[model samples]
Every structure is written in C-alpha cells, then in structure tokens.
Target: MSIQSGQSAIEILGPEQPESAAILSAQALQLVEELAERFNVRRDELLQLRLEKQAQIDNGKLPDFLPETASIRNSDWQILGIPADLQDRRVEITGPVERKMVINALNADVKVFMADFEDSLAPAWDKVVQGQANLRDAIRREIDFTHPTTGKSYALRPDPAVLIARVRGLHLDEVHLHWQGRPIAGALVDFGLYFFHNYQQLLDNGSGPYFYVPKLQSHLEARWWAEVFAYTEERFGLQPGTIKATCLIETLPAVFEMDEILYELRNNIVGLNCGRWDYIFSYIKTLRNHSDRVLPDRQAVTMEKPFLNAYSRLLIRTCHRRGALAMGGMAAFIPAKDPAKQEWVLNKVHADKELEAKNGHDGTWVAHPGLADTAMAVMDQYIGELPNQMAISRDSDAPISAQELLEPCQGEATEAGMRANIRIAVQYIEAWISGNGCVPIYGLMEDAATAEISRASIWQWIKHGTHLDNGQLVTVQLFEKMLLEELVTVREELGEARYENGRFGEASELFRSLTSAKELTDFLTLPGYQILTQKTVA
Candidate 1:
C-alpha cells in the first residue's frame, strides 16, 4: 500500500520462495526501510493513515487512500463565462414551491435563474438527502413537485442556477456553502467528494455547473477551495479544468484580498458579484462598528461615490487583468406602481448597466422576476453586441471602436435611462406603501434592516452618479443641486408632517410604504437620513 512521506511495507514466508515472491519480498523490505526512514520520526499521522486505508480496503472501498493536494496554478481570472451580463441579467430564484417562476423568467428571456436550496429552501436535516433526491428524481425522470401527502403542488419547478450540488455532476452548488457563508477547512474534502460525482451527471445533460462561491474571506480562502477542487479529477475521473467557480466577495475581508482571491482561483474562477446589501451590512458591522470606528447612520453613508467607485474599479481591473468576466451586484428590487416608479426602476437598471459596462462588468442580477423585463431590457439596451475581434458592425457608417463606445459608459449612465430607472426605483418603494405586496414597507416592512436596504438603493445611485431619464442625465452635481433646490425641502416638509403623529404602527407603516414605493425616499427618513446628512456631504 502507498504511504505518506513515500513509504510502504509487506511480509513473506521465506527469503527463498518463488522468484516473483522473493523479488516481491525484497521490494517489501525496501518499502519497509523507506517507511522506517519517513514515518519513524512521526507516531500518529502515519499509523492513523495506514489504519484508515486498511478500513477502506476491508470495506471494499478505496484500494489506496492517497492524499490529493496541490498548490495553485494558472492565473486566469476572467469571469467572462457568466451566462449573462452583470448589470442586466435577471437572476430570480425558484423557491421550493416556485418552479413556474423559472419558466416564467425564461419565457420573458431573463438571463439566469436558480433553484435555491439555501435561503429559499428549508431543507430538513433528517431528510437532508431529500433535497438532492428531489433534484435528481426531477432532473432524470421529471417527477411532480406536488407533496403527495399534502396534495399541494408547487407552482414553479426548480431551475438549477448553479449545478445542483450532490446531484452527480452538480457539485459546484456546494461551492456557495463552503466559499460563501463561513470557512471550515476540514469539512471541505467531504464536500468536494460529494460534489465530484455530481459533475458526471451534469455532463449527461450537456451542461456543466457555473457556480457562485459565497462569503469568501480572502485570497487564502479562495486558494484553499482551489486545492480541494484539484482532487476532483481523481474523485470523479474528469479533466483537470472541467469544473469552474465564482466567488462572492461579500465580506469586508474579501474586499481587501481581491487580487489574492482573483489570483488564487484564477484558473477556475468565473467572475465576482457586487453583493451590495450584505456587503454594506458587513462593511458597517465588521469594519466600522466592530472595529470601533464611530460611524454616522448606516443609510446616510451611501456606498456610491468614493467607496463603490474604488471597489468597482478594483473588481474591473482584477477581472480584466485575467480576461475574466466582472459582474456588478444586484439593483435590488424596484416595486412597480406609479409611472414615476416605473421610471425609477428603469433608471436604476440603466444606470447600473452604465456603471458595470463602464467598469468592465459583463453581467448583474435582477432579484424580482416580475421586474425581469426592465432589467433585461436595460441589458439589451446597453450591450449593443458582444465584443468581436474581427470586423463587425450594426451600421457601417457609424462604426466606432468597442472601447470608445463603452468608455464614457463607465461612471454615469445616460440621463434618459437614469430618469426612467429612478422612476422604477420609486415605484418599487411605493409598492410596499401603495402596491400589491401583502405588507406595506412603511406599513409592515418597518424593520430597520429591511428599511436600510430600501434606503441604500436611492442614496447609492445618487452618490455614485446622476441617473438618466429620457435624454436627461442627472449628474451627481445636478442631483445635489436639485436636492438643495427642491428634493430636500419636499422631504423635510413630508417628514415633519408624517412624524408629528409617528406612532409605532404609523412609523412601521411608513417603512412598509417605503418598501412598496421601490424608492429609497421614505426609508431615508428616520435615523438613516440623519446619518447621510451629517457627514456625507460629498
């Protein structure tokens, strides 16, 4: 048997047995000597590994349990393989009961969809295998998602966004668990083994997984994942580069180690996502509060200007350096209601497209499928066509360098696009207050956390760039000037009038309304607004 530190051992009856046996006996002696030299210095690791090998053999499993490890290789972190452009792609998920959403999204031409087993699912532990069972039984034979016992059927069937983990060949799904949420080094090998087999099944379907690795802490974390990934070749008998991974740089630590993360997982890397809401929370909770940095209100400090600019630029550079696709984060949901709200969602999507396209991102996520058309339309609008090295053009006379066309699109988007998006964002905000969701944002979605997400959407846009509207771009300077001239007065007048009788339910309802509005205005009231005005004048 093979052993660590390059050693082996065996025994025989006599030194003068058959020729082969004697030769084997001598080789066994040589192996013992090597083992003595290598493992003699160590007591437990060598002995324990041997014992595990014995157990595997006795159970008719592994003939040899060799350690599969490797250092990082190939520095290609181009996130270009993403299914859609970062700014415009709609990535709605089907809940355990939401399969139809996937078809609906597809019918509308959304860029991507996920069958979520993480947050959207409540997979019971005892029935842990059920999740994979549901996926496999459905993937292979197309079983109904109806709970036979309950006689209740799911409206939407599961759609695999990343590969379905543990579904032979669907292992990349587990990347999110290991890389994203939290780091646990040892459990990773187990996870890798479980997913490797899934890749085989994925190949059967003529598709391979494109994973989203969540919550990566640093370049080191990405590196470790790469190491485990290398072992998959042996685990499932696949080519070296068959599997792929994309890290979600959500945590604060990950932001600092972008280059490392990109460098380490470069070969297998897809692209990085702009995880705004969670990232902001981490930015506030980990960097500011945890580190004892006194901060203003969370909502007040829009991550638009210097922060998002620097961060996004870094992401763009990192991806471009390796020719990987760099994706922008989600534009959250814009509740549609008024014409103004429609305009706001349109503005945000287009502006997001502007920022991403300008920064070199290829794709982004749209949270709500109902709003998929708006996001997809924005992407369709901005992405004139994929970059082609050979000569190609929509109009021969209007030809321009691809770089030239996308150059000015970097910072701010068109004015018309911005105005339209802003209206949609406003409409999204109005939805909770006045739209169709069961709860009003200001009315019911009053939790500080939910309210904060709503607030950040608007402030972030204004802070980053002046949004666009039907041929009019609202530059930050113009937006600021307008706030000085008109928006702030309206806000103050409304805040005072509303807060005069702002009881618990009243304030809560206001927050609920904010969610429905799909605009950040109402949430920008209360504590969040003060934080913005106090120190973020820039």
Candidate 2:
C-alpha cells in the first residue's frame, strides 16, 4: 500500500512489479510520480462520483444536462482557435501504436492519425513502453520497418498525417510502473511519457502535441485534464495552448454534459468526437437496471436511430456553437476478402461519411487505411474545400431534448443478435487475450469496447428477460445454448489446429464470467488484463 503524502494517496495491492525500464527512466518516472501524487486522489474522487451517479441511475434517475451549467450552454463561447495542422481534418485514421501501424497510419493519405494507446491497444507493459518509443520515432521521422518474409521496407511519407496520441482512460492503472510502491494512473503514464518525450520534437516538425481524450464522463473529468495540461505546459516551459485535445463524448452522461465538458477544457479543447461503440456500452451499463431501457440487437443500433442521431446532432451543435470541430463517429467496416464485398463495404462507408459531412461534421474517423480515401472523398463532396462545415447551420431548428437522447431504439431482440453477441464477444476476447486489441471481425475493426457492448447487451437482455421477435425469451438457458453453438462455429471457422492453439476456451470462459455475473462488470478489460499479463498464448 502507498504511504500518505499530505493529502494524496495511491495504494498498490501487490508488491512492486518490474517492467519497461526504458520508458520508466528516472526522469520519466519523476514526471509520472508528480502527476500521480498530485492528481490520483482527484481521479479516485471522480471515480467515486461515478459510482454514486450509477446508484442514482439504478434508482431511476435519468441523466439530463445540469441546471447549474444551463447558462454555460446557452452562452455564446468558443474554444481557442486550433493549430493550423488540425484545421482541415476531414478524415482521421486511428489504430494501435505498434511500429508498423504507427508508420502506416502516419503515411496514409488522411488529415490526421490518432496513435491510440487506449481502446485499440492491449496495454501490456512492453506495449505501453514500446508504443511510446514508436510514437517518438514516428514524430522524428525515424520510424521504419521491413517485412520479415516479404522483403518489403516501409517508411513514413515526407509529410505524414498530423499525429494525435490518445492515452488511456482514468480508470486504468500502470501496474508495471510504480511510484513509492504504488501504481500510477495509466493515463498519466501514457500521456505524461509521450508528452514529456515528444512535445518539443513534434513542435519542431511544425505540429504540437495534440490528443484524443477518451471515455470522459463529465465536465469534472475534462477539468482534470485541463489542469494536467496546464501543469504540463508550465512544467515544460511551453505556451498555455501548446496542447490541443479532442474529447470523446463516449459516455451517456457525457452526452448530457457536452457543453459543460467543452467549457471546462475551453482553452485547450479543439474538438469532440462521437465514440459510438463505447457510448452504446455506456448506455447499456447506465440503464442496466431499467428494463424499459433495454436495447435491441447490436446490428439494430444504427446512426439513423433516434438516440444516436440526437447524440450526434447535439455534439455537432455543441461543438460548432463553441467554435470547436465536431468530429463524426468511426467507420469500423474493414475490407472483406472478396472484391465485391469490399466494394460494398466501401460504398456503405461512403454513405456514412456523406451523411456526417451533410450533417455538418468537420471530420470523421476510419479504422482502416483502405477506407481513408473513401471517407475523405465523401467529405470533400459535402465540405467542398472548406476546412470544416461548422459555419453551416445544422441544429437551429431541430432542437434535441434530453428525452429524445434517452429514448431507446424500438426493435425486437432476436436469436441472431444473441448469437452474434456471443460469437463476437468470444472472438474479440480471444484476440484481445492474444495481445491484439483491434481485430477485423466480419470486415469490421472491433476493439475491446465492442466486446464490452456485446457482453453488456447480453447481460442486460438476460436480466430484463428480453423477448426476441420470434417469440423466444432471452434467458440463461437460451444464451448458453447460443454460446455453445457459436463456440462450435468459431472452432470450425478457425480450424481445429488454430482453435486449439489460440485462447478460445479461456475466452469463452472469460466471456461467460463477464456476462453471467450477478452485477454488471465495469470494464471487460479489467479482468481480462490480469489474464493477459499472467499467461502467454501459443
């Protein structure tokens, strides 16, 4: 356990663990220690606030915009202008921070590349440290890789995409790096190490340190980041606005507090993104106890749905009204092996991007490099040389209410949905356990958050006794039956040799553990993290 330091305390459950000494050098450790000793308490307090809020929600308290911050919402205010590099971000590509991925994402023909250390990464100790090293090399244009067998060498372009590093959320901890026998917050470790090492180098190359803040739940969390940025800039002798960030309004509560969230980080924030998958997971978790709020099949939740549309429009309205870019959601579809299927998927992505562009989104996200051009072309058609579509009036007439945003999708749960939830959850968890956070499953790039959605949806359905359109109820017996069937399908798909070698059995157990719990688990990765670190897959 951590010893008390004045008012701050961080306790480590286990004894000191060792990993990643390169990124945990004396100087980097000092910076991380400073952040942990100062802000870990506040982080804990905010997390406690989350629990309290969940309790209120469990008791049937529907989330709404704060009455106290109503004036802030109604007031006309804008974030400080963004750096020039970020101005025309029509399309942004995102991926894990492996060396090859870093190089490819930077060299891709996109406006920005989000080097993700969060959802798309498994966050093993080596990955955490090496991902930092990878980003540093990419920033310096020193990153390169040669395919082991293909004899093909890859390098960065002369003008790579603008880089934005996304650190982990506040709930995670870097157990490998400890300060005075206590683990530091993973967010601090990730953002601090990257910022401490590469802030100046990025600025020297004509871009500053930009970020995508993930999984923020309220304005207070945004305020915490603002304080961190202020301290970091002052500590590193950079200008106050040297760091620009885009917050992902991924949580249901955050959707309500969008304006307030931007207000807290007003000077440093440049945009807000729609974290569609995590938002759905959060929605399910938030309303898990409320039978009336149960959602339909995962495929049934589309952007055109009422709740999602309301959320997206409200985000655009909020960001544009504040002079911040309102970025669109991720196009998760990857290319299928068949050319016809790939073309169909690309066209679907084009339509999605077109809707976003027409709806006044300044930028959008794509998971694969192949879709970047498709997304950008759609944006080009709608935006037409403008950096963003914020000047277009998008939300003046169609005002959204809290009820509209909270309104659940009207569709029946089906056996297909349940089977898909099981199959996807098991496959994703298996891949995740193998240290891959993002996998192209059924031509869509799925991360741990998608697995969360699957398991949480299953849990909610079983808990609420949701009935399918075909008149079958979502019960434990039915779920178990579907899970067994999906397991057989997964085995056959992977082939016997590969199935036995991978972590499918363990993944199935993990998925069952997550969904069959009496209480909703907070994060699918939390328990899986232990499994990942403890064992090595063959």
Candidate 3:
C-alpha cells in the first residue's frame, strides 16, 4: 500500500538502531522459532507457534457452565466499581506501562483481561513489537495477570487453569490486535495481516485468537475485515473460517449501521463495544445536517434519544440478536485521588453499569486498575439482586444534582476533585484561545493535557438536569464565577499563566465562548433570566 501519511510504524517511533522495526519483527519470528525448536519436533516452529496462536483466537466454543448471573435490580443489594455481569467474568486491561495491571485485574478475580496494543501504547515502532513478543512468550509459558496492590496475581502459570492470560498472549480465548484511526487499513487490517503473516500455522486446531476490530464505519468495512480474515487464513494454510471478530461500535457512522454491520459480520462477530467519545463527536458532525440548532456538551448526548440513544439500543438488540456480547466503553478517564474522587468515579461507574444493564450491555471496559474496585463494587452490589421493576422510572435519563453525583465521597471532595472539572474547562478555553500546549486553570493543565478530560466532564455534567443530556454544570453563572476565580488563582500560581497568553487567532472566538459560559451562568441568576449568553466553551 502507498504511504499516504508518509510514515509507517517505523518512522513515527524513531528507533535506536537503523532498522529496529525490521529487526524487531525478525526477532519476534526468531523467538517463535526458538519456542518451536524447543517444542516443534523438527519444523521451523513458527508454524507450531502460529498454529497454537491461531487456535486460541479461532476457538469459539465457550464452556457450558454459567457463572452466577448479575442483577438488573435497582436496590436490595449494591456495591461499587464492579458491574453486575462483570462479577461472573470480570474484564480489565493492561498497556505499555502498567505491566501489573493485567495481573491486578485478574487477581481482583476479573474474568477477562486485555493486553492492549492501542491507545495506551505509544507504538514507537522500533521496540513496539518487543512488548508483544515478551507478552506472547510469557503467555506461551502461561503467565498470570497479578494484582500489584494486594501482591496477588491471577491463577497459576501451571496450576489451576488461568483465564487471565496476557491479552494477545500465545494462548487465550481471544487475541485482540488493534489500530487507531490511521488509514493504512487502520489498526485491525494491519494487525490482522501481521498476525496471519506471522502466526498462521503454529496455532493448534481447536481454538484461535479473536480480533477486537475498531473504528469500522460501515457494513462494507465489516465485510472488508471478514474478507481480509479470509485472505489471511488462506495465505497461512489454515482452515478458511478459523477467526472470530468483535466490531467496536465507536464511531457515529458505525452506530447508524449497527444492524447492517452486524449482519455483515454476524457469524464471525462476537461483541459490540460502545465507543463514547469519538461516536459523540461523529454525532455532532453528522446530526447538524438534520437540525438548525447548535449542539450541547459532549457527554450529555450519549444517552440522548432520536440520535445516540437509538444507536445504543440498536447495539444491544443487534448483539443479542446474534448471540453476541454487548460491551460498554470506559467512564472517561477519571482521576484517582482521595475518597471523594474515588466515590465520584464510582458513581460514574455505577451510571455506566446501570446504563449497560438497562440497555443490555453484557460488560464494559474498566480503563484503569485503581478503578477496578469501583467496577467490582458495583458488580457486587447488583450481582445478587435484580432491578426494581417498579423503580424503573420513565425518566431513567432524568438529571440529578451535582452533589448527588459525587455522593459516594460524602462532601470530602478536595478543591482538586470538587472543582476539578470546572477548572479544566476554564483551562481549555484559555489554551484553545492561546493555541498553546496547555493552559493552567487553578494549577491544572487544561489544554490538550486535559482537553478530553474537560470536554468529558462537560458532556456528563450538562445532562444533569436537562432533557438536552449534555455535561452538567450547576449553572453557567455559578460555573463562570468559579472560572474567574480559578483564573486569578492560576495567574497567582504560574506568574505567566494569564488570560493574555491566550493570544491566538482563535482567541477572540474562544474568549466569546469563555464569556458565554460565565455570562450564561450570570444570566441564569437574573430574574426569569433566559440563557442569553453566547455559547461559552471549554
């Protein structure tokens, strides 16, 4: 394929050696050879490793026994962090740094653990394959995901069978490979080809690695993945249909075509992942065609009907229709601070689980290990019970107070956690206008550093009391008052962190929005004050 971006994984990562990627790839193959040389009777051995790897991924037969069912109940039993279904078979992940995250997730008794290659990884190319190689070798040797906090790891390397193998390990129920939004056939195609090229035959027969496909926007894309799988399988001398796939329903366009995508990938598809952010962004960019009105906060719209909510519902229906699992996305990276931040995060986790159960998602991805307890707690609380049929309100989407949102922490929210969000919003406004890396808002990073964080907060907060379903702020007026105060605080702290640094071409527009978030808050206080403020933004 032609290089549209003028960079492949190699050039982007800036390696130590002249050809680190090539060397790494060859080294990975050599490692497989050694494993084979050690065990492969007399062949090149990659065939054997490939066969084993492929079998692990291709194996679709889930055991017949069912773990205890999770509750859909509103009360009776409750906990925090954990989701109901998660209790049966917990799901967690690991990235480049948090090597112990997997072990920790499993040690917490989680059921599924993903060794993530996307998002969390920087993919420096030269040594990019090193981790995957290390992880795969570790898995072949049967490594366990351990919990760092408790000093406890998942079940054995050789003892009782372990379900918590490193994600993409040599052996596991699924071997999910990924690609972000890059156009080189994106992550899935690129990784899938790499997998097939590298590990087609060493794979044993009964099972094979599974693929978690992402960013697919159309039925054609799903079909294309299936076709790619077919080609890869054929090239590797494997059975024509030995691969399984999960379509990540992250983008807005993909959501619209969930049914068709599922239909296209039906037999091979195993689950649907709700990608909250990118999908929301897509909605704003797409739905504008259908409306004259402007959009609101990003988070609020996730559950909004006539658009996102419809897609979410379709997701559950489509997954269940195909006897597949429906998975929820992350709770927007919540920080781990004191009890208050923890509790606030727990609430968001609860909300996700609640929505998952309500919408029929089987499980969700808990992004951080620290939040595992929150995920687990929620699961424990609901696992033994069922939702209150009577408690199921028509206004399930009804907004609640900000205090209620942070209730688990019980008034202990530090200025950081308590005012964390509003501060970030101010920082973003300042930085966006300033065209800088990050702007300090009350001693916090608000540019790209916390842009997503701020945006996510606004998205969730806006939906608190409105049918509009966006991020909630007590009031734009109250928020503005806080914003101004934070600005003063930042200037005191940074010396150079001032509104004046916001001197970009976009500053005028950004300032207008900053004024709007505040003016709107101010107007909300006026007698019968209409929301006359121009759109103030983060």
lDDT of each: 0.41, 0.86, 0.41
Instruction: Evaluate residue 35 in candidate 1 and report its C-alpha lDDT on the 0 to 100 scale.
Output: 31
The lDDT ranking, best first, is 2, 3, 1
The CA lDDT at 459 in model 3 is: 32
> Counting only residues 3 or more apart in sequence or on different chains, how many pairs clash (N, Cα, C under 3 Å) in candidate 2?
0
Model 1 agreement with the true structure over 415-528: per-residue lDDT tens digits: 333233232233233332221111223212122223344334334444333334343443445543432333233345447654343232333333334433423342232332
lDDT by residue (1-538, candidate 2, tens digit) is 4323222233323333243444445666667778887788899899999999999999989998899888998888888788999999999999999989998998888999999999999987667778998888888888999999998999988989999999999998777555666567889988888988888898998899999999999999999999999998899898888999999999999999999989899889999999999999999999889888999988889888899988988899888888899999999998788989988998899888987887789999999998888998899888886888889656565789999999978887888888888998999999887889989887789997888999999899889888888898888778888888899999998899989999998999988878888899999889888887763211
Tell me the spans in candidate 3 whose CA falls farther than 4 Å from its real position.
Answer: 1-23, 26-90, 94-108, 142-207, 288-293, 302-306, 333-335, 377-538
- Show the lowest summed lDDT stretch of 10 residues, model 3: 522-531
Every candidate's CA RMSD: 19.0, 3.3, 15.9
Q: Clash number for every model?
A: 94, 0, 71
| Model 1 spans with C-alpha error above 4 angstroms | 1-108, 118-130, 137-197, 289-303, 337-343, 387-538
